[model samples]
Target: MKRYPIRAAKYAVYLIILFFILFALLRAFGSASPMSVLWTTSRGLMFLGVVVVFALLYPFFGFTRKRLTFNAAERADDVERIMAMCGFKRIGSENRPADDMLFEAASTAKKVAMMWEDQVRITTDADGVSFIEGNRKEVVRAAFRMGTYIA
Candidate 1:
């Protein structure tokens, strides 16, 4: 899986909001001693760290991986073009154990928006069955477009 180091601007704004919310909650329900400030800050930082980790992992665990099987007569090139129409650009192909074609978001901004899950890997078997593994929305969109035009 390829990683997009830069994230969308909205995510940074969201994280800032989350940090403030965590700090406010900690201050409200915390102890009322002089050292409570330090304690609350530490606890809020820890909680924020956990939330950030969960947000980072959400893309990997939250999406469903689906396979779209095309007819034997449909050419791989046609499928590649459909994927392009669906907002993915073919990076290249590799002769792995299975026939694999790799694709990424069409533009740099789209790639940043997708973050870590921008690349979609399509594996075509000898029987013309191709499995598209990526974010569920992207996979489904590509599958739907291919089905509409090719079927």
Candidate 2:
């Protein structure tokens, strides 16, 4: 999976704010005998709290923007390349196996190709099948491969 730098920065900013708030609360409520002790404790607590918050929120904000040259579209192309590596071809664009044949192949062979109107999905032993969604071809391909055929 790709990492989004902007989201990471946002998370950093959130942590900073959280740290300050925690530090302030500690200073406001704790003993005032030793300033150094208070500062050190507050800093430690702030760092630990921020780490915990980041861990809790990572999955939700992790994949917003990738710092890669490849955008979602390029990622889709990569997915297509992977499918080709798996002996899967574009449904109408390539000399692909027939629908029934592909289905049977998927059922019996260790690998299979699944095609949908908007996507192409593939499964192989080396690279397990994945479902992709959204405007990316990879997502679409994944969706096709993993999607259940609905009458």
- In terms of TM-score, which candidate is strongest? 1
Mark the regions of model 1 whose C-alpha exceeds 4 Å error after superposition. 1-53, 71-74, 94-98
Which candidate number would show the highest lDDT if scored against the true structure? 1
Model 1 global lDDT (CA atoms, 0 to 1): 0.66
Give the alpha carbon lDDT tens digit for every residue of 19-125 in model 1. 66766776688833343443378865676576567657655554555667564134667877888888887775554333677888998888766654587777777
TM-scores across all candidates?
0.61, 0.27
Error of 1 at 91 (Å): 1.5
Candidate 2 pairs with clashing backbones: 120-141, 121-145, 131-142, 132-139, 132-142, 132-143, 133-139
State the C-alpha lDDT per candidate.
0.66, 0.39
In candidate 1, how many clashes are counted?
A: 0
TM-score of 2: 0.27
Per-residue lDDT of 22 in model 1: 64
